[model samples]
Target: MQYKLPVSVLVVIYTLDFEVLLLERADHPGSWQSVTGSQDEGESLRETAVREVFEETGLDANHYGLVDWQVQNIYEIYAKWQHRYAPGTRHNTEHVFGLELPCVLPVQLSPREHLSYKWLPWQEAAGLVFSPSNREAILQLPAREKARG
Candidate 1:
């Protein structure tokens, strides 16, 4: 089986007021998260972020402030998800990004990957995400935004 690229992007889509946009995974109903996807071959991290945001939410990253946190996370691949990767692949490197808008924006969910979407406050959004790293990323948003000031 072909292995997935080790690099991926995690975009925290939020508004100035901290309302974050989350999509429920079609494969896992209760698993909600910001826009995320693996990087395509020949795509830069920035390109991956922009493409994922558009593909997953129908929002143009160019219309908002897309910030690269310059943070990378290496984590063990969940046993259930390991099949997506090559044999012996046990970890992935995730790069964090943020897309900040002035308010909650309309989104068009990719029907194949996401079943629904919601805009929730940062704290609540953090609690709803299934992945610990995803939750941690949401929790860091406020601090990350402040640091950008």
Candidate 2:
């Protein structure tokens, strides 16, 4: 079995107006989040972000504003998902990114990875994400946008 790399990317896809796109997990229904995935060997974090966004939402990230937030979070892998990494690998490092779209657009989710998708106000989206890191990223959207501008 191929074990996943211990590095990943978390991409918060949102609009200039603060509407965020979230995907409901297929494996764990009701758990909604932005585009996220583990990095493959030889892939940079930015590449991981773009690939994950495409895989999860069918959005061409390059056509929009994809920014690496220059933030990293090291966290314990969820107990149920630890097996996806090498044996005894309990932690993963996740790089943060943001994909700024002009507006909310329909998404085609990878059925195996996500069950559904939605566009919600940043606050509501932040409140609904299952991961604290994801929530924090969404919460920072306003400040991040201001800084970008």
Identify the candidate with maximal lDDT: 2
Model 1: residues with Cα > 4 Å off, grouped in runs: none
Candidate 1 per-residue lDDT, tens place, 1-149, comes to: 56688789999999999999999999998889889888888999999999999999999998889989888999998898889888888889999998999998889999999999999999999999988888999999889878878
lDDT value for candidate 1?
Answer: 0.91
lDDT by residue (tens digit), candidate 2, 1-149: 99999999999999989999999999999999989999999998888898999988898999999999999999999999988989989999999999999988999999999999999999999999999999999999999878777
Name the best candidate (by TM-score). Answer: 2
Question: Where does candidate 2 clash, by residue pair?
Answer: none
- Relative to the true structure, candidate 1 reaches a TM of 0.96
Query: Each model's C-alpha lDDT?
Result: 0.91, 0.93
RMSD of each: 1.0, 0.6
